[model samples]
Every structure is written in C-alpha cells, then in structure tokens.
Target: MSWKQQPAVVSAPPSEDAVRIRTRSGIAAVLFLPALFIAKVLLLATDKGGRCFVDDIACAPFPDTAFGALLVAVVLALVAAMAAPVRVARGALRAQLLLEAAGVLVVLAYP
Candidate 1:
C-alpha cells in the first residue's frame, strides 16, 4: 500500500517506527540465516583423510562427525539463546533447530 493511502487489505501502516523495525528485522533475517548456515557448514564439513586421526586430531566417519557437530551446535545455541534479546533468540534458536534437523538427515544419509 502507498504510505499516504490506506490499503484495502488490513496491513501495518508505514510509520517511521514500523518501517525501522521492519528494516531491522529484514536485515537480521538476511544476515542471521546465512551466518548460522555457514556455522553449521564449518561444524559439519570434514576432510576424508581426516579418515585417519593425525597425532592429536580425532577423525571419525561422516555420521559420527556430523552428530558430534550437531550436538555442539545445539548446546552452543541454547547457551546463546539464554543471553540474547527475546525475539532474536527465538529466531536464532529456531534456525538452529532447523539446521540440526537437516544435519540429522545428512548424517542418516551418509551411509
């Protein structure tokens, strides 16, 4: 709807506060999802000859590694959610939950 004209359908009016809040939300969603996605990728991605452990490095197979990564991410997310702004925490944890679900699927499909 035009800022000056009320819409036929009921919708939020484009007030300055509303616009600013919406913009912040839009930017958060844009940055948050990909950042979390990349976090998961960093957590899950592994090298094959990571097939065998190097001196101190423990390299397991895919499912084991993925499961361990999921566990770590879940714990981290829960801890972070405790300290975050309510709305931001909810969104972050929800996205983490989804990424964990996908990680589970990938782990299951590994064999």
Candidate 2:
C-alpha cells in the first residue's frame, strides 16, 4: 500500500460564545490586580515565607509575582466557561467585573 499526504482542512470560525469567553478572559487578565490578592492569600497559606527570591527579604514588587498566575487563571476561567453548555458568557464576564471592582474597592479602602 502507498501512503499519500492529504490537504489541510479549513475549519469554521469560533462561535459567539467562544469569542465572548476569550474577550472576557482577556479583560480579566488585563485587570489582574484582583487576582493578585487571591494569589497572595494562597501563597501566604501555602508558603510561610511568600518571598519569590532566594532570601527571606521582602520585595517591593511582590504583586508582580501574580502576573503569570492571574494570566493562567483567566485562561482557565475562559476554558471552564466555554465548557458549560448553557452559554453563560455574560454572567462570567459580569462576575469577573464585579470581583475586580470589589478588589479595587478593598485595596483603595485599606491602602
């Protein structure tokens, strides 16, 4: 038998729900200060020293540690939202917005 290569196939564009989920996730990642708080809490719980560096000294740019974490979280949230059959894109986006707003308020109030 002889083997032959087949041409590439073209798939349809992503659905509206997929687009919405991706857009929301992008927005969440852009405004990641809220996720910083969550990441900090988790770090404090898991690691007594929460320092990113080798030494135990505190770093001023500590919140920068959450950047990658928040990006991954946002991507995961979009994936989860896409998996749901009910298409709750708006709800997911709204919840993210609310959380971000609350986080901002808390940060402002405390600091």
Worst 10 residues of 2 by lDDT: 102-111
State TM-scores per candidate: 0.37, 0.42
Residue-wise C-alpha lDDT for candidate 1, range 19-87, written one tens digit per residue: 444454445435644664665454445553323333334544466676677767765665544445556
Cα lDDT of all candidates, in order? 0.54, 0.55
- List candidate 2 stretches off by more than 4 Å: 1-13, 34-79, 82-86
Candidate 2's residue-wise lDDT over 7-111, tens digit each?
999988778777767676676757676555765465545444344334556534434345445445545555555555436755666555655554444333321
lDDT of 2 at 69: 54
Q: What lDDT score goes with residue 52 in model 2?
A: 39
